[model samples]
Target: MKQQIPLYLGIDGGGTKCKARLEDAQGNLLGEGLAGPANPVRGLALSQQAVLDSTLMALEQAKLGQGQLPSVNACLGLAGVNVALYANQYKNWRHPFAKLHVMSDLQAACLGAHGNQDGAVIICGTGFNAGAYINGQLTEVGGHGFELGDHASGARLGINAVRRVLEAIDGLCQHSSMTKAITSYTKCSNASALFETYHKATPSQFAALAPIVIQYAKQGDVHAVEIMRTCAAYIDLVVERLQKLCPPRFSMIGGIAEPMFQWLNKASQDALVDPLHSPEEGAILFARNNEH
Candidate 1:
């Protein structure tokens, strides 16, 4: 009887989207797929669906049928799995793969950025977080979710922009560039529309406003300048905390990384480095290293 070929799956499950890659035993690349957000906090059903959707797409690209799922070992690095309760809840969740290991998205990003070497990554997409892998030790900061934390994140910036707009309406703050920009973006000509738009907005929807803020700031808008200043300060705080565990060598990842990079001070900018591999590739490395 011939032995079956082994397959591995690596997933980067972020707050905004889930990405997956498939590889054979010898570390050769196979296929890749993408799906919606897989943050467990977003809801177990949605997360599971995203994981399945992305993994199935990957398998399809590899010319493998659904039956092959039972032969594949997988590592899922997901956002919102950092919370102990969510981790515990999702750890026992059903999946199609033969083996599955769940960890934080930041962990996957860090591993991907450094290729499992000692280094760190600051992720600033719809959410913010820093992960460090040093001396075989792992540490993470931020990623407290949209409600309590995620300072310097796209979502946070968007939220701040809206707040300033409201303040301006109330005659509390000057109607600076961001206020005009957000109001235009939201199409909220009146106070009621402004309230209605934000009240119904999602994190991704809010994050969409961040680029507008960036646009205005580049044109030297007063409010836009202050927003970036505050944003940089938050990112600086996160880096300072991570520095205690690892060196300043950092690769900034995610949708907002580039804009944030430009706003960061020269010292912080100096610390930024290029990633050796992508998060999905890092997930593959994680799968390769852990074979129980």
Candidate 2:
């Protein structure tokens, strides 16, 4: 009999965007795909569509076609895996791939960070979330959606920083560089108009404001510095708690985490770990569906 060709796929689905990669059994990446936000909490339909879109896009990018795809194993690192509602809903998703493995985005980050060893990973992009993997088991904290939590996340930074700017403008807080910088970004004639964006903007849009905060902080803006500091502290608290929960080295992913690492105290920063691999690669590493 002629030998069958082997193929595999890895997916990193997040609140911001989804990334997919096609690889061979020996782990050589062949092609890639990019998709939309896959947060189940936002809405099941949206999450499912985004994921499916990305997956199909990936297949198209690889040019493997369906017959070759069915033999491919897929690992999906999603944003809202902890919510049983999401998981249950995901159970119904049908794909052409031979097998599919799903996990929280943090789990994939852990796999990317420690490669299946014991460790903790914090995701700090639009919203915050943390995960611990010990002995192949996964534990998670935060990521409870925007209103309930997600401290130290990009969304929180922007929301908080903007609020501070409003406060300063209204004499609620002392004047600072943050107010001037934020006011420039808002371009609002008056504070009352600021509500326009706040009322209509999405969480990711708010998060995009984080860079303004960071910029003001570098210029010695007290409010901006405080915002960044508070974010760092929240991240520290979560990681410290995870340490008690898992007792392993700590690592981080997402935009917030990469910057927060710089703001952490030297000792805490010393223990930081750069991701050993990307979440896309991590998906392929643990996927059992890959052909040998």
**How many clashes (backbone N, Cα, C below 3 Å) per candidate?**
0, 0
* Residue lDDT tens for model 2, 95-196: 666788887787777887777667888888888888788876777888887778888888898889778877877888887777777778878646678877
Model 2: lDDT to the true structure = 0.77
Model 1 lDDT tens row, 188-267 = 96678888988767678789899888888888888788888898988887777776775635888988898778888776
Local distance difference test, each candidate: 0.84, 0.77
Q: How does residue 274 of candidate 1 score in lDDT? A: 88
The number of the candidate with the highest TM-score is 1
Model 2 residue 2 CA deviation in Å: 15
- Relative to the true structure, candidate 1 reaches a TM of 0.92
Q: Which regions in candidate 2 have their CA more than 4 angstroms from the true location?
A: 1-5, 65-69, 245-248, 289-292
Candidate 2 pairs with clashing backbones: none
